[model samples]
Target: MEPGATLLNSTLQQTDASVSLLWTLTLVPLSGETPRKGPATMPLFGKSHKNPADIVRTLKENMAILVKQDKKTDKASEEVSKCLVAMKEILYGTGDKEPHTETVAQLAQELYNSGLLISLVENLQVIDFEGKKDVCQIFNNILRRQIGTRSPTVEYFSSHQEVLFVLQKGYETPGSALNCGIMLRECIRHEPLAKVVLHSEHFQDFFNYVEMETFDIASDAFATFKDLLTRHKVLVAEYLEQNYDAIFDQYEKLLHSENYVTKRQSLKLLGELLLDRHNFTVMTRYISKPENLKLMMNLLRDKSPNIQFEAFHVFKVFVANPNKTQPIIDILLKNQTKLIDFLSNFQKDRSDDEQFNDEKTYLVKQIRDLKKPAS
Candidate 1:
């Protein structure tokens, strides 16, 4: 046997063994309530992974190969997608605490330093949605992993603001919108990134994006919008306070949107933001406005039961406010009969919701017992 032939045979065997291992690991069977940890569960390297850096190098190389081959779709990039998923599993571990190893922590830092994350963000535009989701799942794992007190990926991206700017640009494409939205929401856990996004002009585009003709992308953008406002209550309150006129100007448009889903979901998120204890000032300012009340009132007449139900919750806040402004009082007073009639028959579908029933009863009384003022 020639020396070159022996070397080639040995290399082929190693490649075959690795492929076999990947197949076995990916096909592990589920047997119980708890998740099963298949072989090669370590970050980067498999179970026998000796060096974490090698695993990072292999993932980066595979990612580069996939990037070069597929500029149009990810369906044909199954092998590359599988490799990414396997890396995620290894880094995240089977259970919550199991993968928080020292090596895994370093793996997070190394991936950041290697610039692979930027490549993943850029690939969102070119890859198919499933491939994009695989990339997002990896990001979710990174954001969820903590080195000491915070996520390494979050820490890295906090300073690398340009990556986030590109990620936000994903909203421009339907194929990438949902994946980028998910990754952006994960990044919001780090306050610096959150503040940058909230303060930037990207904040204004949210309303338009949420109204996109593409339902999936629109809904995903809406979720990201809601996450930004609700995830960090204190920060959101400050933003709303500083930019209330502009933010709610757009938000009210969302409430008046012809899209039933947008109207309903925005109403629901509005209720959440107001009812949250941290948003007292925001809630006070919001319910004080009569136009907002009128918008909620019109929403009550929406044909969709879901929209009507959500609208009822928000409308109750305006009536329930003790310090209602004259403008607010005037709207409620003029519509007192209609409001009473509406609440009388409102939310019968929620007859079993005791709390809702009590609230409805209270709101009706509040409207019924109203005064016509000194005039």
Candidate 2:
């Protein structure tokens, strides 16, 4: 064979071998091993051999799918459900083992970084019954997380405050209300998050939420609303002062609410606030109005003993305020006889309360001293 022919044949044969190797590489898996996804990957069997981050990551992806569709697929739902259960166990732990603190810290940080909390709450309707509970547990557990004195999770919430309002929106959805309430209640325990909720325009919605037709939801909403107004007294005082007109306007509506519970609770809360030293300014402002005095006076005669009792507690404040507005003084003087007569017989069953007996005596004298209209 000639040198040129032999060289060409050798080149062709080498090219054919290279082509065969390339085909084999593309067509076959080496040793049949699939690429490892991560520890705690789904079909999660039991506990994962990998990191909890895998659970957070998989759960986040599944949640994205769940959030986009109103009707979630069972497979995705179950997968997310499984991850939620595992997440709960990871954060709160099982009976047999405590959750590793470091692991939880890592997971909490990752969850925030991924914005999973925002997604979970905004799409809470997609999670199933038990899964919704797991979501709540997961959130509260993470919310309790703090590094040193600095609460990283609280900071995350402060930055992503929309999550807090989404929880508020949950009140309208019966399925998610209590769960959202639980989460929101926890969030507000941290001052930053509470301030965010108190200052937001959404705060107005809480008035309506507390009045919703659903008994449990309205009750839950009232609990949250009360906390917002009373939890951080200093913060609340400032908010009330800045927004007094708006706040008390809604409050007055509650005092006149057709719902018995609403009227009673509002009256009780009014007394509590007006009596609180932190709310001195608000109380003074509230009692300055003759219209407010008239409302409390009317409530003092409400049919329900409980309502009347609560109203009397508020009514005493008006008669007791030394700096009574001129309108307020006129109303007190006009009702002086009726006020003394009513207090003498008011809540007779409360005779056991020494403090109440004394206050009733004090109010009677204050009204009698109102320079009786020369009758």
Candidate 3:
């Protein structure tokens, strides 16, 4: 054989073997699970793995391949996605085959110890679109793993909260944003993870993300930000109270941002946080601020009816404060007649929202009856 022919044959053999290994590893059945269909599972160099730990090890190896390859070929990513799907199938059964609880539990522990989740998220930018989705599914499934009343994945992340924050950094990467945001929301659903993120110094970064130039990234981030703030009400209330001035300082900027979406979402979130009974102290403090009241009043006049409507939900809190501060009362009295006229006409098209109209009338009556602190 010619030297070039031998070289080409060697290359083809190597490629074929790599595919065989990936395929073998990809379809490798967990302990006691049924053998997968299609190509039969084979030995690696010679050793075959049937333990559930082998599944986790295989995942970590492919995940490493994704991380190490700065310039990933389509074939490489396809193999990784296949591995991810296999892992997902193990966690959630395919068709009539229910997943083996013991196998899943073993896989969950192996995944946590292997540090695969962190590696996957940190290298998510290198992954292709479809593979990113696969990673999201795999990560979310692992995140849902539980033992009795306790969630092991959530516990793992509570100490390794940086993984969630790493996911947040992806918000800046165009390919990574929505995928990262999805995993992020999943983690923060657990109170411990939410508490860590809520208290992270970078927690304020969400403010910047929600106002970015890209609509999809910004909107997805806003959704995650909303979830973190609203998912665990008690944790969120503590976060808001402990970090009130700083939290709302960033929040207040969003209420007036040139990005209309930012302004609308922040206003809506403000109404939600301020009105929740759990956040009574925080809401009381928020409504007492003359500056906050003024911001809400200005938002009331925004050209977008949606903004005006969201603003009303927040603005009414200021009006409804039974123990309104002198400054709050002064602002309401100053804008009393103007507010009545504005609320009277504001979002009038929502005639079906009897509650809104009633609230509007109530706000009108509240301001109208204000005695200006008996001064």
**lDDT tens string, model 2, 222-316?**
99998898899999999999999999888888988988887788789888988989999998888898899898888888899999889888888
Candidate 1 residues lying further than 4 Å off, grouped into runs, are: 1-86, 89-102, 127-133, 347-350
Compute the lDDT of residue 270 as modeled in candidate 2. Answer: 85
State which candidate, 1 or 3, has the greater lDDT: 3
Give the alpha carbon lDDT tens digit for every residue of 80-197 in model 3. Answer: 6656766776788655558889888887777788887788899888777777888898899888877789888888888887898899888999978899999999988888888888
How would the candidate models be sorted by lDDT, starting from the highest?
A: 2, 3, 1
Per-model TM against the reference: 0.75, 0.84, 0.82
Which regions of candidate 2 are displaced past 4 Å? Answer: 1-50, 68-72, 372-375
Tell me the deviation in Å of residue 248 in model 3.
0.9
List of clashing residue pairs for candidate 1 = 40-47
Prediction 2 global C-alpha lDDT:
0.84
Candidate 1's error at 328, in angstroms? 2.1
